[model samples]
Target: MQLKKLILLVTVLAGSYTLMAQTDKNSIDDKQNESQKKIKKSKTQLKDAEANFLLNYYEQDGDHSPVTGGRGTEKLENVAPTFVVHIPLDTVSNLDLNFGIDFYTSASTNNIDYFEGRKTGASGKDVRSHINAAYSRDLRNSGNAYSLMAGFSAEFDVTSFNFGGSYTINSKDKNRSLSLDALYMNDSWKLLYPYERRSDGTNWLKDDKRTTMKFGLSYSQVINKRLQALFSAEVVSQTGLLSTPFHRVFFDDVNGIPYDNLRSFSHVEMLDDNRLKIPVSMRLNYYLNDFMRLRTFYRFYTDSWGITAHTASIELPIQITPSLIASPFFRYHTQTSADYFYEFGQVSKAMVDAKETQFYTSDYDLSDLSSTKIGLGLQYSPLLGVGRFKSPFVKNKQVQFKSIGLRTAFYDRSDGLNAWLVSLDFAFTF
Candidate 1:
């Protein structure tokens, strides 16, 4: 069965912000002088509060499932809905809130009780809920900003808590910027083992808690009027129980055990308790014309677990009209297998007895593989919004139906795993 909390960790780390680095340096230098002359000392007030609702659907299938000794159905489906809102707290500060829920089912996880000829108690279906909030403020006219954030997530088998903060500085001209971020997360797991192994009375793991710490740095620069680039790097460290207790690993030399009785020759997945990872990436966006733009990204990743990887991606966005934009993108990624990874039944009891196998796993997610993803995204936005209504919270104000966005993608992995994803977004301003 899949430990869904592991997937949540990846999702949390993927959060990012867009860089608005634009420099039309010779932008009629006269415009800047004239704007400064017309301006007076005043407090920065947000004209409107912003909000968005997002929904996502995902489906995938594969042949290798560690829960079944690395050979079983890996079909899964998930739907997630999220909401985000930002409210102006004062003239220079704002509060942001985000919350979401994920509902999912997995055939692989259902097989967790296969050996017992039962499926009702397995993680066949589940739901996760999460919430996060942040408070941010800008140093008046000092080109500095800072934010503090806190979040929590929970599911049937795991619960997590996280806290973080960020600081950013921008050049006076607003064409260059740097940001630093730090986060710490702690998780407590409700230990569950393979159905058969649970009755064996063996303490498979010494700990059921995990902790992660991450630090990131990023810089963005605007080049001339047509190009902008961002560079980022992050270091992540994790410790404690890192392996799934329900994942099974089979050995080849199990005294000719029947194939149907795989659990008799299987052991729980094992791995090191500590890990460190580093990833560096760069993104470049080029303005080709008023209607088209090109965006490119590249990343290099490595970890203490003897895995290295590279990823590259490109996207082209075309403006069909003043209110419509279409973007198509493609990405490719390749990575080496972890040192302790092995296929089904590739290990032996003799190796373990002789201390030749201190750590091992049959998880294909850690195996050598390549993947490709392609997608198209569309956004519809109008200058005056599609609809408007009176604001309920503010006097003499209106709420606007700002925009709608949709994106769909297909992913293919060399290991016979394939997935599809679709997402929708609704944006509003009040």
Candidate 2:
């Protein structure tokens, strides 16, 4: 039969030539593993552009606030000045960049005698300033990241901008991180005082403006192996000039001014307050070993006619060696004002009826506040000759708290007590 049909046609041509020689050795081992992963990602992006870093600072803020009888504790003497900068690159190339700047000023005339302003004559030396800037980067390796922020200020007539980004998800092996933010703000309000005298005159809106839109969501987790947690939420929606042209609202059934035929004036007439605000935050970290470390945080606030708030913080660190360390912190605050507050010269409505104030005026942001604070901070450095400080509760042989340079924090708060605060931080690399 023709040699058994030529042995089944050479066994189907030797099984299709060994399946095309193993598909050409898997296409030449996938092009030599994509050309050695693009030459190891171009030598890790040329050693992460040669890594970099920079830092600078100047700080002061003493006698923060402490007033009693002496006219609202003389506005707690505000002396605030700050500055900082940082840069880094070369963590094996995964894109990482950062920028910074923040400035604040206080001529501290006890914050203008805590608002009385010489019984009503408001002045701010010219202007109070607040500035900000930020930046972040990292993408490609997939676990993306992005950030941006802007700032401005002048008695809340500030301007702000924001942007955020984060992503990272890995299952089974466990890994999570997600973040989002988008914020915009505008604020302006300069109470009345300049107008050809008219029974405490001052009208024609100063510069009232209010605009807001904020939203955020965050997450990070690792509940074990040293503990860690983070969660966040935020929302805000405000609408234009929420009234405060100096502030003074009383009708006592119309003693004088509140709508035409006006007269009563101490301040306030820039009407327009449409708002909605909400904030929620949380953070926790624990690592009580090798040198102890602990942190906690919480925040909750609400707005929309009625107001509510809460805040808490805690920190603890004690490492005397390995470069020194010291931390002792505590914070707590409470709020419940804005239902229409008052307390100064409160009874008005008889300028033949009223210019403002009588059960729905005062508005010191609705008065109702509470506060608390205690702190201690210190950090010394010398590159930690190697290591020091260890007592995860007390494990013997580990008593560290050495000093080499700078690190200080001391603050006391309760509205005033002569308000005091100080902070100085440091780092170095080359």
Candidate 3:
């Protein structure tokens, strides 16, 4: 009986040790699993942080442009250089602050040495400057975005203030980029006119003042991974002083010297009616490949002056190789004459006498005014390195360096005025 009892106790002791060993192995397995999970989480976090850092450092968007001639609604035919800069906000939130300024010199754009015109008063060519700043922000809802912009060209003669916002709605896929935006622009149009009067006949002392408010809306759709289409429309409403005072006009009733009729003066008329205009535009962009692309657009315009026109333009960018490219563009425009447009010395004898001339007259009212523009230029972005700022920032391998656009236009007016307007643009990035 004592021997049997000893054997039973030994068996119990071995069973207890085996149970203990199994428990210890289970504990060790749990610890190893925890360590592995921690390592994987750390690696994922490191990768995410590295990507974010890269996105913030090297991302860049910039534009440098020099444009000369091409007239529309009192636009200058002179050449001007403009630079634009965009800096990232570097926050998780989609936000950015964009600021830039313009340096305008009359010497490079104008060919005149000096003229004592009634506008300049023999003061030689005047110089003008402009500055702009703005802030942009993203909305809490992934569909909305907005920005505010205000700037001044010259306090004395030029300044503008504007605010705008944009949004997209109810999209199935968040990866697809599609959105629409609307903006309002309010402005005073008295800038760039010289108020000084001197020996030169040109003077702005007796001019009518006008202010305009405009509304615009745009829609963009991503056709695919490589293509997009844009549509936009804008309307402008203008009121206030519409005519010039110093302008000369001779009435039919006043064959001789009249009490108010003026001689050799401006041709602007004073009218109680306000003005309204609408401009509609459409654009299509298609990427044939990574190195080739095509951009095309059509615009239609009309105003209160009883003028209407259509414009069509296209740009073809061909990649010669990886580092070099050539782009050619063409545009066509056709429009009717304004309601008040007239020929030289053409005035109504029945209207009230005024101090202004019947100078608003353009012989073109007898027919139609049409214009065409064609240009070709080369682009080079050689010896480039991959930008760490984004996954693919150095796209277009040849980035636009220098481009020259040459164009000529034709007009059919009663004054028999026909000429060609030439324009050129050059750009670079630093």
Best-matching candidate per lDDT: 1
Candidate 3: segments with Cα more than 4 A from true spot: 1-79, 92-124, 140-143, 155-159, 167-209, 225-227, 242-268, 271-273, 351-367, 383-430
Reference-based lDDT, each prediction: 0.77, 0.41, 0.38
Model 2 regions more than 4 Å off: 1-141, 145-174, 178-182, 186-204, 211-219, 222-228, 232-280, 283-308, 311-361, 369-430
For model 1, residues 214-293, the per-residue Cα lDDT tens digits are 88899999987999999999888889988888888887775467656665666888999998988889999998998888
| Residue runs of model 1 more than 4 Å from their true location after superposition | 1-6, 11-43, 119-123, 254-258, 391-397
Clashes of each: 0, 33, 22
lDDT of 3 at 185: 35
User: What would the per-residue lDDT of candidate 3 be over residues 258-295, giving only the tens digit for each residue?
Assistant: 32223233233333347677878899988888667888
Sort the candidates on lDDT, descending order: 1, 2, 3
TM-score of 2: 0.25
